[model samples]
Target: MQVKKCSLIALAISAAVSQMAVASQQSEAKGFVEGSKLKVLNRNMYMNRDFKHGQRNGTKSYGEEWAHGLITTYSSGFTQGTVGFGVDAFGLVGIKLDSGDGRNGVGTGLLEINDAGEAKDDQALAGAAAKLQISNTVLKYGNQMVSLPVLAISDSRLLPESVTGGLVTSNEIEGLTLNAGHFTALSNRNQSSRDSAGMKSLDLAGGTYKFSKDLIGSAYWAETEDYFRKYYGNLNYSMPLSDTQAFIVDFNMYDTKSDGLGLSRAWDGEKLDNQIYSLAAAFKTGAHTFTLSHQRVTGDGGYVYGPDGNSTMYTAHSMQVSDFNQENEKSWAARYDLNMAAFGVPGLTFMTRYIKGTDFNTTLSSNGKEWERDVEAKYVLQDGPAKDLSFRVRWGTRRTADIATGNMEDLRVFVEYPLNIL
Candidate 1:
C-alpha cells in the first residue's frame, strides 16, 4: 500500500488567520461568585443484544442490562483581573438497576465487573480542573473530558470517559481556535479508578477556523506513545437554496502510521500504516433531510484509534453498532431524517440509515462483506411539569460474512431529565 503524507497540515494552520477582530474574553471577566453555574442530569438506560453466531459471555447467547446514571457539573467564572483564574468540577455515579454475571459483562459499558464476572452494583468518580485565562487564551490542568478531533473522550455510554492532562486553548486570532494538550492517564467509562485503561502519554495539537457563516475547516496531529501517530483534516460547507432548504457537504480524512516502539506494543500486533477518508452530502427542505456518504480504507492494515478514546473516529460510516472500518474496505451509506416540528410536534424526531461494506481483507476471506441497519426515535417534553424530560429508542441489526465478530441485533432505550441550579 502507498500512503500519502499529510503535508498540508502546516498550510492549513498558516491559512487559518483572518482580519476579523475578536474581543478579549479575559478583559470582561466577572467575579467568580457572580458568574458560576451548576447543573445535574439524571439518565436511565437499558440495552439488550442477541448474538446469532457467537456468545459474548462464556455460555450466554444474549446480553441485557439496565442502569441509572447521575452526572453533576460545576463551572466557575474567572476572577476579575488581568489574569483570571477559575475551576471546573464534575461528579459521576452509576448504579446497576438490573444485571447478573450471565446477562451482562464486557458488552455494555454501564457497570464495572469483577474478576469473577459479577457486575458491580455501583461506581462513582469525581474530578476537577484548575484554569487560568490571559487575553483570549486559557490554560487548564487536571482531570477532565476533552473534545478534540484526534483525541475525543467517548460519551455515548452511560458515563463519559476522562483524561488527566494539561491543555491550552487560544482564541487570540479571530475566526481561529488553536488547541494543544499533553495527556498521561485515562479513565474508562465503566471504571471509577483513574488510569484504568493503562494508557501512556498522548500529545496533540490542532486548530479550527471559520471562514464564513457556512464554511469551516480544521486540521490536527496526534501521537500516542508506543501506539500510532495520526494526522487528520476536515472541511464543511453549507449552501442555502432558500429560507427552508440547504445543501451541505462534509469531508474528513486521516493518515496514520506507527510511532515510537511501533506496532511492537499494539494490542492487536498488526502493522500500523493506513489511510481512511469519508465524504458526506446532505440536502434539507422543510422537515425532511436526506443524506448519502462514501468511506474508503487503504493500506497494510485497517484504521485504528485509541487507547485514547473509542469514539475518536469521526468517519461518516461510524454507525451505531459498527464502524464499517476494515483493511482495504469500502462502504456506502444512505440516511433519512425527519423533524416532527413541521407537523406540529415540537420536540420529536426520527432517523433511519443503512450502510453496506465490501472488499474487506480478513484471514478467513479477502473479499468479505458486511452491512448494518439502524433506526431511532426520540421525543422531549416541550412544556409543563416534565418540560425538559426526554426519551429515546434505538434499534440496530448487523450482519457480516467474515468481516466482523458475528451477526447481532441490539435495542437500547434511554430516558433523561436535566436540572439547572446556580
Candidate 2:
C-alpha cells in the first residue's frame, strides 16, 4: 500500500513539473496583508421533556444546558506572484458549562467525555488551512466548511462544522459565480472522533446565482461512497407588485443515487431512481407576510436517506413544516414571520409554521401519515454590553407512524457574538 501511494505521489509531481516546464510559468507572491477574527458563542438549551413513540412519554425527564465555544480565524492576503498565495487559520474551543450523567452529549464538540467517564466542560481544539487567490478565484484547504442546501455545514449546534479537503470559489463572471470542492473527510458537529473518514466525496459543477436584477438560480453535484450521489437545483424570483407588497416564488428539484456501504445499503441498488421536486411562494406587506409551499417525491420505497440512515426529501422545501422524510410522499408547509422593529423593538422577530405529509409507505403498515408544528421567536440586544447579540427560542412538536422516530419535541436557546480580530 505504501509503495502504491508513493507511485501515485510521484506521478502527480511529474505531471505538475511537466506542466510548469511547458508553460514556462514563473511563481511569485502578491500583496502582503494579514487579518483574523474571533467569535465567542454560547448555546444554552433546555428540554421540558422528550416525546417518543407518538406520545409525550418522558414528561418528568428534563434538565441541562451548556456548550460555550470560541472560534478564532486568521487569513493572509496573498503574496506577490502569478498566482497569489495565502493561508487561513481556524481555532476552536468548546467549554462545557453544565452537564451530568443524563446530559453528557447535550451541546457540541468534536470530543466528549474524558477518560474519567464523566462529562467535562471547558476545553479546546484548533486547526489551520492554506489558501490561494488568483484571478478572481480562491482555493482553500485544511479545516473547511462548505455550505449548500443539499450540503449545508450545520453550525447550529456547538462547534462549527469542519472538514479536511480542497474547495474553490470563482466569480470571474459578473453576477455569475462558481463553487466546487472535494471533501473526503469530516469531523461532524460533536463527539471526539476525528480519525474516521466519511468516505471520498467528489463535488463539481456550478451555476449562476444571479442572472439579472431579480432572478437567481444555482445547481451542483456531489458524491460520497456508501452514501449517495446527489444533484440539485433551485430558482428564485422576486417582483414588486405594489408599493407595500411584493411577490416571491421558488422552484427546486433533486436527483439522487445510493451506494450501499454503511448501515445505509442502497435499498434497491440496481433499480434506484428517486427525484424530489417542490415549489414555494410568498406575499409580503409591511410587517406581515404569508408563505405557502408544496413538495412531492416519486421513486422506489428507499428513495431518500437522512441522519440515522432514512429516506428524505428535505433538500429544499424544508421549513418549520414536518421535515420531508418519506419517499413517495407529498408535503406542505405554511409559515409566517414578523419583524417587531417597527414597534420600537428593532431586533425582535417571530415565526411559526405547520407542515404535513401524507401517503407514506412502509412494510409494518402499508399506508401512514405524519405532521409537525413549530413556533419560534427571537430578540437581539442592539446596544450596550450585548450589542449585536441575539437569542432564539424555538419549540417544535411532531407526530409520525410507529416505524418513525415518532412524537418529538425540541426546544433550544442560542447566543453568539462575532468579534473582529484585525
Candidate 3:
C-alpha cells in the first residue's frame, strides 16, 4: 500500500492530466457515454490454503493474487432543478496476471474457461450496468451486481458477482428504502458467459421489496419452464435496546410445486418446500463489537429465494452453507471485532468468528455434522498521502465431511484503495 500510494500520486500528476481533461470534456457533451468516469483499483490477495474434496482438498502451502479492476461510470446531470430524468452506466473489467493450474485452489481470482469439455485459463471478466430514473427512484437494468440481504450481490472472490435484469430502488422517504427487481440471468465470476449450461431462467416474474424502520418485507414469484412455481417472502425487524445493542429477528418462507411441464431437480434434486428462520443480536461499543446469530432450516430440501443459491440470506457465512448434503441443520455464529484507533493505533483492526452446522438427514448420511472457524486482521495507512489506503488479511479453516467441498483451510489477504475524482 505504501508503494501503491506513492506510485499513484506519481502517476496522477502531470502524467495523465491532459488526457483526463480531454475525456472529461467529451463526457460532458455526451452524457451516459462509455469510459467517462474511470477509476483504477486493485485488490492484492493472499491465501495459505485451498479446497479439499476430502483427501484431495488441500493444496499448495501459500498462494497470492493481484487483481486490477478498471471501472467507468456515466450519468446525466439533474435537469434544471425540478423533477429530473437521468441515466447511469457502469463498466467493470478485472484482469488476473498470476497463478497457475497447480496452485489454483481458491485464490485464483479468475473464473475457468472450457475447451472441448476441458479446462482453460482466462484473464478477465467484463460487466456493465445502466439505470434510468426520475427523482429519488431509479431503475437499473443490465448486468451488474445488486446488494441486499434478501437479494445480495456477491463479493466472494477477486471480482464481484453480477446478474442480468432490472432493479429499482427508491429512498425518497426519510429513514425508509424500497427495492424491487426481476432478473433473467446471472453472471457468476467463474462461468464463461451468461448463457452457460447450468444457468436457468425460471419463467422470470417481477417482485416488490420494501424496507423501513423496524420493518422489512418482500414478495416474489418465479416460474421456471422446467420446474415448479417458486414464491418467496421474508420479514425482518431490528430495534436498539440501548445505545450500543441491537436485537434482530427474521423469517423466510418459500413454496415450490411443479412447473407442469418438467420433471427432476437440479442442485439438490428434491421437489419440496423450504423455509428458514433466523434470530440475532449485535452489540457494538468503543473499539470492540460482538454478534450472535442463530438459524434454523425446516421443511424439505434447503431454501431458495431471489437469484442466488447461497445460504438462506442475511448472514456473513451463508457462502459456506448449501444443498441437502447436510440437512435439517442448526447453526450459530459468534463474532468479535476491534478497532485499533481506540487504543491510539489508527487504521488497524481485528476480527474472528466461528460458525458450525449439524443435524442432518440426507442421501449421503442419516446423520452428519460440519463446522468452520475464521480469523482476520487489517491495517490502513492513517496519515500521509495514503491516509485512506487499507489492507486486509483473513484466514479460515473448515472441517467437514460430505459437506462444504471448497476451500479446505483458506487464508485470504487482500487490499483495496479508492480515489475520489470529480
Candidate 4:
C-alpha cells in the first residue's frame, strides 16, 4: 500500500470538532426487560436471469428461482446502570418456492445446491450477539450483521449474511461516530451452516463525521488476512436552493493492494494494486430527482471484494447488473427517480438508470466496453390491512465486449411485509 493511503484514516481521526452539545445516553437507559422488542419480516422473492448469448462456452442458458423467507429478530435494550448489557438474536428461514433442476444454477442466490446440482428445499440460520454499553459507546460480540464502508454484510438475497466477530461503536461526540471490529467467520445468505464462506480473519476501523447539516465525511480502512488491505473515503454535501429545490454532490474513493498471500492466491498469479473513485451530482425539485455520475478504475486489477460481502463496493456505478469495475475502466451514468405521490398516486415510486463503460483493459481486448440499463418500480400500501406491505419489481439489461461476461437480462420481483410482535 502507498504511504499516501494512510491519510484517509488520519483525516477521519483528526476531524475538527464543533461546539455541539452531546447528551448522555446512559443516563436515560431503561431496564432490559422493559426495552425488549421482537419483530419479524416475511419476504417473497423471484429472480430470472436470461443470457442473451445462451449457453455459449458451456455456461447455463438461463437461471430462475423463487423463494419465501421468514426473518425474526429480538433486541433487548440496555439495563439501567453506569454499565448496561443487552442481547440480540436473529433467525432466518428460506424455503424454495419454485426452482427446477436446470433453473437453480449458481446465479440464483436464493437457495443452496447439493453435489448433484439440485437446490435445497429449505435452509435455516440463527445467530446471537451480546452487547455492553457505557456512556455513548457500545461493545458487541458474537454473530451479527456489520455495515461499514470497507466491510459490510450483504442482504440482497433471500436471507442476510452474518459474521462472527467483535465490534465497538462510539458516539461520545455529537455528529461523529466511530467503529472498529474484527471478524473470524462468515455465513453466506444461501447456506444453513455457519462459516460457510470460510473467511480466515478480517479487521476494520472507520468513522463518519457531520461537519454541518449540509455536509458529511467518512473514512475507513480494512484488512483481510491472506487477501488485501483496502482504504476508503467519502464526502457528501447537500446544497439547498429553496424549500423545494436542492443540489447534492457526493464523492467516493478506494485504494487497494494485495498481500503476499493474496499474490499467491490470485487467479492469474499476479499482484494487485488498484484505485477506484467516483463523483456524483444530483438535483432534486418537487418530486423528481436527476443524477449524473462518473467512475474510473486504474492500476493492475479491477476492484476486488467478496468473502467480505457482495455489497462492499460503494462506488456510484455499481449498478444492478454490473459494477463497471474492470481494470483501466471509465464509466458514466445518468439516472432519474420519481415519486408518484406528487401525481395523486401515493406510495408509488419509479427509477431508471443507464451506465456505459469504456477504455477498459481485458485479456481479450485492451479496449473493452460494456453498458447496463435498469428500471425499477415499487409500491407500498398506504393504510389499512397491508399498511406496511411493499411490492417491488426490477429489470436490468447488460451488454459487454468482455469475454468473461456474457450479455444478459435480469429481472427480480419482491414482496415484503413486516410485523411487530413485541
Candidate 5:
C-alpha cells in the first residue's frame, strides 16, 4: 500500500510537469523558460550532545554524528498571460559520514534508524509543486514547504520537512497579504516517506496587514483534524530614536484547544487547553543590538504544534535545545547581537542569549527550574571565488535543578556552499 501511494504521487508530479511543458509551447513562455532559476546547496553538518549527568535508558551518555547534504531547488517563472502557470521542485540527498555505535540514534534527527537500531547510510527525498497565478492571487498544489504564523516547515537538520497540500495566497490590496491552505500529510526531516498518521489533516488561514511603515499586525488560525485548533496573533512596532539609534517592540500570542477526539489528550488524559504569550523589546545602536524578552505558558498543557521538533514560537529564547514551554512555565531572556560590519569585517555576526525558566508542573518537582545559554557565530563570503559560501557554529548548554539527568550540552558546526545553476 505504501508503494502504491508513492507511485501515485510520482505519477501526479510527472503529469504536472508534462502539462507545464505543453503549456509553455502554446503560450509564448519566454518568461517561463528564460526567467527560471536553479540552485544547488552543498551542506556539511556535525552535531554533538553531551549529557552532564548519566544518560537515560542506558543507551549512551553522549550522542554525536556528522552528515553531508545536497539540496537542489528549481523555480520557474509564470508564463506571460493574464493567468500564468509555473512549477517548482526540490530534491534532497543526505549521506551519513560518521554515526558510531553511541550516535546512531533518532535523537540526532539527521538520519533514519532501522529496526536493528542502526541509522541509514544514505537517503533521498524529492517533491514538486504546480502553481497558477491570476493577477496578484496565486494557487499551489502538491508537495511543498510552507511557513506561516501557526504552521512552519522544519529545517534544523540535513533536510527540511515538506508537506503535501494545496494553498492559496493573494496580495490584492497594498500592504496586505492573505494565505489559506489544507495539508493532508507530511514527510519529516529524517524520513523519506510521507505519513498522514501524525497529523491526519491540517487546515490553516491567515493574513498580515502592514498598518504603517513601522508597525505590522498579523492573525492566524489552524485546525488539525481530530486533534486541536490553534490561533495566533502578533504585533510589531519600531521607532527611530535618532540617526543611529532605534527601538523595536514585538508581541505574540497563541491559544490552543482540543477538538474532536483530542488525540493529544493522551499526554495528560485530559482535554488540552493552553495559552502562550511572549513580549520582546530591542534597542539597536550602530552595530550592537540588545534585547530583553518574557514568555509564559498557562493552563493544563504547553504550546502545541506538529511533531517535527522545530518551534514556531515567536520568542527570543526558543533555542536549539529547549523551548522553555513547559506547562505553567514563565521564562525570561536577555540577548546581545554584534554585527561585524561595524568593525571593518563584513558578513560576520555573533549572538548570545541566556534564558531562565521557573514555576513548572513536572513530576520531579512542582517548582522546577531550568536555564540555558546559547551562542552562535556565523560568517558568509560576500565576493570573489567563494562568494555566498557560509559557515556557522552553534553551542548551547541546559541545566535543570529538579529534573534528574536532564542537563545537556549541545554543539553544532554547519557549512554550506550554494551554486547558481541558471
Candidate 6:
C-alpha cells in the first residue's frame, strides 16, 4: 500500500512537470524559462565512529561507512504577471562504497537499511514544489526543505531530509520577515519512503526583525498535533570596540509543553514541559574569534524535537553525538575560529571547540557528566579546472562519566564540487 501511494504521487508530479515544460516553451513564458537556474553538486563522504566503551545492539567496537552522492536542484523564476507562478525541484542519489562489519547495527545517515536489517547499496529520492508569488509574499506547496527556529531540515548527511507540506513567507514590512507552515509527512535523508504514521502534523509560525544594523530579534511558535507545542526566541547584539575589534552577545531560549491529546504523556507517562536557554559572548580581533557560552535545560523533560530532526536548539554544546538536552542538564563551551585569509591563505579556515556538560536527569544519573571536543578544517578552491571545489575534515570525541555506549570518537571527511548546469 505504501508503494502504491508513492507511485501515484510520483505520477502526478511527472504530469505536472510535463505540463510546466510545455508551458515554458511558449513565447509568453520566456521570462520564466530563461530565468531558471539548475545546479548539480558532487559529494563524497567518509564517516568512522569508534566506541570506547559499551556496544551497539550488534556492534562491538566501531562502525565505518563511505558513500558518494549527487544532488541536483532546479529553481524557476516566476511568470511575469500579477500573481506569478514557478516550480522548484531537487533530486538526490547516494551510492554506497563501503559498509564495514558493523554496518548492520550502525545508523549512519549515509544509507538506508533494508527489511533484513542490512544497509542498502544505493538510494534515490526526489521532490517538487509549486510556488506562487504575490507582491512581497510567496507560497509554496508540496515536498521541500524548510529552515526555521522551530523546525529545520537535517542536511548533515548524504542527502538532506525533506518534508511534505505547504509554507508561506512574507517580507512586506521592511526589516521584518514572517513565515508560517504546516508539515504532514517526512522523508528521512537516507530513506526513500515518506512516513506520516504515528506522527502528527506540524504547524509553525515565526518572524524575524532587524531593529538595527547591530541588533536583531526573532520569535517563533510551533505545535505538533496531539504531540507538543514549543516557543522560541533569540536576541543578538554586536558592539564595535575598535576598527579591528568587536564584541558580540547572543541569547536564545525555548519553552515547550505537551498539548492537544498529550501524546508525550501517553507515551512516556510524563508531560512534555521544559525550558532551555543559552547565552554566549564572543570577542573578535583581526581574523580570530574567541567565544564562551553556557546552556541549561530545566524541568522534568528534555528539550523536545523530532526524533530524526536536525538540531535547531541554540546551545553551543550540541555536537554530533549528544545534544546535552537531558532534564536539568547544564553545559558550557569554549570555541576558537581562524580565517586563514588574514594570513595570506584565502579560502582556508580552521575551528575548534570543547564543551562540558553535567547535572543530567535524575532518572538516568544524578551526577552524570560528559564532555566533547571537536576540530574542523576546510578549504575551497578559488579558481582552476576544479574551481569551487571544497574539502573538509572534521574530528570529534566525546566522554561520559555514567552513560554506557556514550563515549566515542567520530571522524568525517567530505569533498564536494558544485557546478552550474543551466
Q: Which candidate is the best by lDDT?
A: 4
Better of 4 and 6 by lDDT: 4
Q: What's the TM-score of every candidate structure? A: 0.93, 0.81, 0.73, 0.93, 0.90, 0.89
Query: Residues 1-422, candidate 1, lDDT per residue (tens digit)?
Result: 00111222223223322311335677688878777999999989998888775645545667888999998999999998767899999999999999975788747667888778888889999999998877777778898899888888888778889899878787767799988777888899889988987778888888999999999999999888878889999999999999999999999998888887774222246767888999999999999999999999987678776677878898899888888778888999999999999999999999999999999887767887999999999999999988899999999999986844557888999999998888
Q: Report the lDDT tens digits of candidate 5 across residue range 307-395.
A: 32254666555677888877788999999999999899999999999999999766677887999999999999999999999999999
Model 4, span 373-406: residue lDDT tens? 9999999999998898999999999998674654
Alpha-carbon RMSD of each model? 4.5, 5.9, 11.4, 4.0, 6.3, 7.0
lDDT of 2 by residue, 213-244 (tens): 77999887656556666788889999988887
Segments of candidate 6 deviating more than 4 angstroms:
1-30, 196-198, 261-269
Q: Candidate 4 has which clashing residue pairs, if any?
A: none
What's each prediction's clash count?
Answer: 0, 21, 7, 0, 0, 0
Tens digits of per-residue lDDT for model 3, 1-422: 23432343333333323343332322333333332454545554444455564344343444444445544444444332222334554555655555554554344434354454222434455655565434445556677666654445556665555677666665444444555555566556545466332335433322334456677776655554444566666676777677656666656555555455435342356665555555556666767788787776666665544334222255334533232223366777788888889899988999888887778555555566767787888898977887678888777777766454533676666777766453
The weakest ten consecutive residues by lDDT in model 4 span: 12-21
| Candidate 2, position 346, lDDT | 88
Residues 1-422 of candidate 6 have per-residue lDDT tens digits of 23433443344334434444233322254356877999999999998878775355534677788999999999998887555789999999988889856553364567778887777889998999998765556778998888787877778888887888877776556688877777788787788887522445777777899999999999988777787888999999999999999999999899889887776641236887888999999999999999999999987577866631564565555677777777788999999999999999889999999998998864447777988899999999988899989999999888886566678888889999999989
Candidate 4 residue spans exceeding 4 A from truth: 1-22, 55-57, 263-268
Query: Model 3, which residues run further than 4 Å from truth?
Result: 1-38, 52-67, 71-83, 105-109, 114-122, 125-130, 172-175, 196-268, 304-312, 316-325, 404-407
The 0-to-1 C-alpha lDDT of every candidate, in the order given, reads 0.83, 0.61, 0.54, 0.84, 0.80, 0.78
Candidate 2 wrong stretches, greater than 4 Å: 1-49, 53-65, 80-82, 101-124, 195-197, 260-272, 301-316, 319-322
